[model samples]
Every structure is written in C-alpha cells, then in structure tokens.
Target: MKVFGFAGWSGSGKTTLIEQVIPEITRRGLKVSVIKHAHHGFDIDKPGKDSWRHREAGASEILLISDERWVLMHELRGEPEPDLDAQLARLSPCDLVLVEGFKAVQIPKLEVHRPAVGKPLQYQDNPAIVAIATDVPLDAPLPRLDINDPAAVAAFILQHQGLI
Candidate 1:
C-alpha cells in the first residue's frame, strides 16, 4: 500500500486535520488506513474489563472481538518497541496508509503547522516533509496547503501517492 505521513508538534492540529481528511479521501472510493504514534502511555481498555484483566495477568496478547469490530492488544513484556516497518506489516491490505507522527521515518509527509503554537517549522530539519498545511501564510520552499481545506489536502495526497 502507498504510505504518507503528517508530522507536527503537539497542538498543531495534526489529528484534527487527519480526522477531516479521512472522509474526504474515503468519499473518492479508495481504502485508507491510519497509524498514529502516541508519545505517552495510553489504555483503550477499562480497568475491570476482561481484556484489561488478561493483560494484567501477563497475557502476551489479547484479541477482543465482536460482531462490529475486533482489536488485538499485545503486551511488550519488556521487549523493545517495534519499529515502523514492523507495525506497518500488521495492517491488513489497503490502498493507502496515512501515518501520524514518526517524523523521523523516511516517507513523504505533510507538515501541519500553526503559527499560533509558537513552534518553529519542521520542514527545515525534516527532509521527509514534502508539503506544509497551515492556517496562516508563511514563506517556505515546499508546497503550501490550507489547513482548513481537507479536500485539497486529500487530493494532494492522492496525487502524490499516484492513487488518482
């Protein structure tokens, strides 16, 4: 599957942009998947849930299933966190994968930027960033996209990935 990424500092609206862009891309008749990198410890299961209890009991993996959906939760058990390639391999087949975070990974990425966030632009340091999506005007060498326009961003991604 084709892969693209979004890289930006926290509060720069990466998640918000991705949330809006997903439907825009999907409406065009292509399958899309997303892989997001969380910087902190996170839990999707409740404390009293069976899956939580299984994980607390040292189960290496737990596959929770239902008619609507299934999720596999794996405990690292002190093992090193798997790399991006390893994570990507776990995904089922798809037409595209939009990655969030993994700024260091060498895939083409769009840098989500908000000037109000007071963070320096990442494009200067990140070679993988091929475009910038922003809320305000800024001078940069890369292609600039309006962060408010999810359709345009989705179109750019499709064109860049040769999915169109």
Candidate 2:
C-alpha cells in the first residue's frame, strides 16, 4: 500500500486536516488507514475495563471482541516502541496509509502549517515534506495549498501518491 504523511507542530491542524481529508479520499473508492504518533502516553482502554485489566495483569497483548467490533491491544512491557515500519506492518493492506506523525520518518508528506502557530516551516529542512498546506499566503519553493480546503489537499495527496 502507498503511504503519505501529515507533519506539523501541535495546534497546526494536522489532525483536523486528516479528519477532513479521509472522507474526501474514501469517497473516491480508496481504502485508507491511519497511523498516528503521540508524544505522551495514551490508552485506548479504560482503567477499570477488562482489556485494561488483562494488560495490567501481564498479558503481552489483549484481543477483545464483540458482535459490533474487535480490538487488539499490545503492551510494550519495557521493549522499545515499535518504529514506523513495524507499525505499518500491523495495519491491514489498503490503497493508502495516512500517517499523522512520525516527522522523522522518511516518507512523502505534506506539512500542515499555520503561521499563527508561531512555528517555523518544516519543509525547508525536511526533504520528505513535498508540499505544505497553510491558512495564509506563504512563499516557498514547494506547492502551497489552502489549509481549509480539504478537497484540494486530498487531491494533492492523491496525485502525490499517483492514485489520481
């Protein structure tokens, strides 16, 4: 499956843009999966939940199932966190994988930038950033896209991935 990414500082709207872009791309008959990286500890299960208990009890992994859905939770247990490649392998095959972070990973990506965020543009130093989406006009060698336009952003990603 092809992979693309959205990289930016926090509050630059990476998650919001992805939330809009996913449906836009899916409407074109493509299957999409997302792999988001978080800097802080996060949990998908509640503290008092059975899945949480299983992991707390030293279960390396927990597979919870029901008629509605199924979820698999894997505990690192002091092991190094899995890298991008390892995380990608865990996802079912799809037409495209939209990675929401892992800025250090070498992947074709668009930088979601908002000048209001007061962070410098990453594309200048990151070869992996092929273009940028911004809320205001900006000058750069790479293509500049309107950050609020999900259709345009989705098109850019599709074209970048040769899915168009």
- Clash statistics: count for each candidate: 0, 0
* Candidate 1 CA-lDDT value: 0.95
lDDT of 2 by residue, 82-159 (tens): 999999999999999999889899999999999889999999789999999998888899999999999999999999
Q: Each candidate's lDDT (Cα)?
A: 0.95, 0.94
Q: Name the candidate that leads on TM-score.
A: 1
Per-model root-mean-square deviation over C-alphas: 0.6, 0.8
User: Candidate 1: minimum summed lDDT over ten consecutive residues — where?
Assistant: 75-84
Q: On residues 1-164, what C-alpha lDDT tens digit does candidate 1 reach at each position?
A: 99999999999999999999999999999899999999888889999899999999889999999999999999888898888899999999999999998878999999999989999999999999999999999889999999999999999999999998
Q: Which stretches of candidate 1 lie over 4 Å from their true place?
A: none
- Model 2: CA > 4 A from native: none
